[model samples]
Target: MKRLVFILLLVFAGICCSCKNDDDGGCVGVDCLPPETQTGENTFGCLLDGEPFIPRGGVNPLDCVYQLIDGERYFNLEAAMNDAGFNEIAISITTNAKEIIENQTYSLVSEFEVGGVSGKYIFNGDIFDTDNQNSGKLTITHLDIDNQIVSGTFFFDVIDQNGELREIRDGRFDMKFTR
Candidate 1:
């Protein structure tokens, strides 16, 4: 009986180990968290090519960068791995926005730029400002003007410099701004 119990225990351990090593050793099956709904604790994550993309510039409590210039508002957010080989995933939004409110949807225009870059910027090589062929929107779901906390969801399809169309989806952000 003792030998039988030990064998069963070993079998259980093997099953557990296998369950945890799903290809990339990340969560497997439907239990894995979707990137759009994964934002908690003032962090950001999204899906690119069905893989998890989280911020790599260290987990910042309030890393969402914001700026106001000439009656326009801009927001920039990014994440990357520690290695230089990894491309930094980033998004910048520009608006003639004033008094941000919940449920405000802004269409991302191709001509919008900040510091010489377009509004719908992507780090994926060959991809530039969202091509004129597509349109994107940024929706503000929550705004705490007193605390300066903001939450939003966005997605865009942009053409690369080579004329290839790329889709970025399931994106979400919750951040606090200084200004």
Candidate 2:
């Protein structure tokens, strides 16, 4: 009876180990985030107020757009997800700069101006943005214009019109850009 019990315990242990979550491509926990990569894997994720915010749905949840207006270049990176009630939540980072260079960091600002960056959070039709009272940083780790791939990391605090504050942290994205 002792030997049988010991064998049963070993089998249980083996089963528990095998059932552990080991998916590297998926978020692991409540505070889990997507892996930061320089390749254009169309991945985007962040932590919103300590909860994981990952883009969902089947079509174009992550997007990067590069445009040239009045001879000035600008880029917009956006990630969006749908909640349980089908409400859309999104985060957008836009830069009003002449050019985007690799290994450069941009400041999040309230107003749109030359060489300034802006961050926005939209949920249920309410928009919050980084203002003078709140700010954040976006660092471009890799930018390949020829291949149209861009990767970056960012974190910010934004305020809505009603003065509600939302903290976004550990943000990262790797995606292909469209010009």
Candidate 3:
């Protein structure tokens, strides 16, 4: 019995020592986080869920990065960097949906996930209410720097804890962006 107790104490001490510091301010274990960046055209360098943060030289059609929490939306690196204090950030754009997703047309939505806590994003001409990191949108309008004069949607679906996608059904409504 004494040997067992001694072993357990040593194990606990080791676990306590293994925890690394998270300098990001907002998250614990922030350094363990993965960032997927869109580089070049329709390509990306990603080190995502369960994978080590190894920059994939380039992959086709980059998918938006996200994490799921109780049916609400959470933003990853891009969105987090866009506005740290501001939970939501709005940027007007002028382009089609396909163009924006491809990064061919500039956009302003970046986040890692959508739900444990809610963050807001304004896209096209509507506000998106994020639930469990699942639902949100991004919109753009005609701005002086760029002028396409079109509408687009930045929709998000909840992702399961295992890094799997949870299907979202279609609906029509105006979701509000808190920012």
Best by lDDT: 2
* lDDT for each candidate structure: 0.57, 0.84, 0.29
User: What tens digits encode model 3's per-residue C-alpha lDDT throughout 1-179?
Assistant: 99999999999999989877644434422233333222212211111222212112122112232223454323221221122343232321111112222222222233322212222323222334345445444432211113212222333444444455433221111111110
Question: Residue 156 in candidate 3 has what lDDT?
Answer: 41
lDDT of 2 by residue, 132-172 (tens): 77899989999999999999999999876567788898999
Q: Tell me the TM-score of model 3.
A: 0.19
The list of candidate 2 runs beyond 4 A from truth reads: 1-31
Q: Model 1 RMSD to the real structure?
A: 5.2
Ranking by lDDT: 2, 1, 3
How accurate locally is residue 10 in candidate 1, as Cα lDDT from 0 to 100? 100
**Candidate ordering by TM-score (highest first):** 2, 1, 3
TM-score of every model? 0.64, 0.79, 0.19
Each candidate structure's count of clashing pairs: 1, 0, 34
